[model samples]
Target: MDHYAFTLVNGVFEDKVRTDPNNRKPPTLIRQPQLGLKSYFDGTSNPCDKNIPQPWDRLRDYVDVLNRESNEGAKYKVIFVLRHGYSLHNYIEKGVKKVNEAGEEVKNDWRKGLKFAYQKEVSLEALRGAGCEIPRVLEDHLREGDPNAAARVSLYDAALLPKEIALQIRGSEVTNNDAEGLGEQWLRWVAEDEFPLPGAIYTSPLRRCLETTKKVYGPVFAANPKKHKFQPIIMENLREKGNGDACNYRSTTKYILDKYPNYMPEPDFTESDEYEYQIQRAENGEPTESDEELEERMRKVLKDIFDDDKTSVVSLTTHSFSIGALTKVLGNARILDEGDITAFLVKAVPL
Candidate 1:
């Protein structure tokens, strides 16, 4: 496989939008097409420029120019990376138990959530003493009390919380009232801004991501009658950084196909979670799929996208950990909130 250096095209967004974690504002491009300021690709006061109706068109034209002027083995693409909506794993990560559809707490202790034990402050020795894995830990007491209990297993390929189904659906609605133009309603603004529809969509195989991709993009593609069909390809490497948690674990390819009959997974996709049973961590300073490994995996996926898809715009429905690696691979550090949709230009140069 080859590697590419991914560079972000800056000055197209507000400084705080990507740089400031404290900025609670959702980074939607509808209202601020050029971020309410002149972009590096701002149009000149010419007749052609004056005729353009939207700033997004100018931005698209700029990306075209960038690709045209770039050297060989280099291209510019606009990618909209959307984090999956709030999931059961997210709720459990905050130490909350699973809730039933009737708004009552699920007393099934076996369905408890997992923690990021590897990233926790505790030392590895301490974790080992407690027979802990990076993302999944079998506490000594639990092991001693009941070795085969359901709680021993973390969330199995976590699904979205019930309320998020409504949240994302509502967010997708277009609003005619300007007063209702808040950031949380991202899809509305996306439609308003005339953001280019993704020529290709690549999603993680996790249930939450699969569900988010369908719910979010189904309407997006439906509204555009002439656009390509809403056919998302489930790529295995697009999964989150594995932490040995069942949430990061994915379902079998057949199971996914049965659930989402329309999804076209990679030809070689297997019937089981390929990476679920692998060693998630390295000891004695050995190499593992932690920091560098995650970046490398993201690079391969990006390379595949660049090589296989000729689309100017691409969409990805993934998780925060995967996005973290992706942004790093793209030379970005911005983090996305749950259900947040962000777009940026990527300059990929083969290395």
Candidate 2:
């Protein structure tokens, strides 16, 4: 696992271990099996060795386990914009390393592209297909470049499951199993110690977001909506940015209602159609949407979502790419990984 250390002078976070001259190693991560604890590195070539313990002297040598649990990351995020947890489709994509204005590494809320194996880190060569096919996109996405160009795998070729089901890794078929341990992440980020109760929830109509809505916050809202001012609403525009089969295709409202009876759909919202034109274009290798068009629609969607409610706090469930659009609309945000929730406070700049 990747060990991390933080410089906290008097219980306040300062900088990551590698970035600080005083610390040599990060603190060790902690886990519990009864709670179904699992790390993002669970299925990779190398994962956390739970038997190991961090001695006080060597605390820095261990990965910073307390960081994720302390609600420290929560202080920065107020408007919770959550990405669905790991999915079968994320295999080819990796994390995007980013630096903030201060030039320090800004850890993604979801820790995308995180590799946990200590010395036995999974190598690209090891991930080669049975047919000796190098996962070119996965390779490029991990290695670093313009992500949009390098991070694509045809849904058909990837042999991925439906977008809504929890991703299974290796041979584990557990649904919403949080293969990357995102459930634990959600628990930390949304708990009272971290974020405030949401006033509303706006979700993508796709199965993954829908499933996430149930898995992540269902307990809080389902038990008592009035107390939290939480109401889950489905919006067609919240789906990923595409007119293609993947973005356009979705489960019927009846199917969703059957699964999550409490979810409320936008009025006048009806069935969805997989755009035949877009699908055909995709089949023939056409881009889903131009940057200009995508941004325009995203801005429109953001307008509707903001106009829908004036709640001080709200939770939004959507996909990765769309989250970029959200970042554009909301000042600035870190790149999101699956099942990652980024909460931030917002102030309206009246137009």
Candidate 3:
């Protein structure tokens, strides 16, 4: 079976490393348990086996293949991972009232002391007076319950409304829109200098990430028209962390608790099992396992990619949480900090 090894470093992949000869730095080998009979086969086993191979053996075989096939001449192939650009959610928190089926106000658990219906009506009127066209669908959704209604309104329709009201809301901000410049720089660095681009590009499903990818890649494809044949793969594994219901209490309360330690009431002097249960649920990937699930999903995607010798060079654009999980699964110590990019390179070898 063909062995493969890969490492992600600073947004570039190093498929094969050279020994200094005079000062040889032996190749690093990583080995872990194989789940079944494949464990006894040694590092060179059939790739088609359905059983899980030890992680270390997988890594060693990956590297060994590159060494043999290239006669020691192969350079590592880098894969870039990055977070999407900035967005309005970072700046302001605006509230809209939720209305029941009867069009009556329904108080949100997270937002207390605010009228559930009147606030949105007043805000909509204010926006209309300021030259915004409040979409009936958006208003209806706000009155009802729609997960992506807020995002859609903020991105495409907010501009039609009042500047002051819009100013109070948050929007995504792209640093640069020139795709050609970014693509040129990336190509030059990767092809000529053999250096990885400073960062990988990963984005959330939101409009901001899509916009960022379009702008950054536009110029690169423009300059090298042929390379335009390749496009990024959007993986659900790279999505944001918030997921809750209409009460709004789930995500917001957690955020508040994390931010202002003293805001919530002190733990009751009499602790109950329920208290521990709640805590455990919060810590045990409750509310949303999107990040963890994404990591495992990405691992499978990569495993398949490594199995194919013809596949070389690819990019993944996704969100922060997904990137963090991916980095950890790849053996990195911590999650990716905001706006950071990480790269990796994989090598294939005949074990």
Q: Give the best candidate by lDDT.
A: 1
Error of 2 at 47 (Å): 44
Clashing pairs in 1: none
Those runs of model 3 whose alpha carbons end farther than 4 Å from true positions after fitting are: 1-77, 93-205, 228-230, 241-286, 307-309, 333-340, 346-351
Cα RMSD of all models vs. native, in order, equals 10.1, 16.5, 18.4
Evaluated at residue 339, the lDDT of candidate 1 is 65
Q: Name the lDDT value of residue 201 in candidate 2.
A: 86
What are the lDDT figures for the candidates, one per model? 0.63, 0.46, 0.37
Per-residue accuracy of model 2 over 187-247 as CA lDDT, tens digit each: 5534523334566788887777887776678665545555574457988777776634343
lDDT comparison, 1 vs 2, better candidate: 1
Candidate 1 residue lDDT tens string, 1-351: 556777776555453443424353333223334334343353222112435667667667776766666666678788877778766456434333212222223322222222333331333344333333323222332244464543332356876655523343334442321111222244564577756778889999999889888877777677675867888999998888775655777888889989999899987888998785684544432224677788888888888888788888898888776787788777755556666566777778888
Q: Please give the ranking of all candidate structures by TM-score, highest first, separated by commas.
A: 1, 2, 3
Query: Which candidate ranks first by TM-score, i.e. highest?
Result: 1
lDDT of 1: 0.63
Worst 10 residues of 3 by lDDT: 28-37
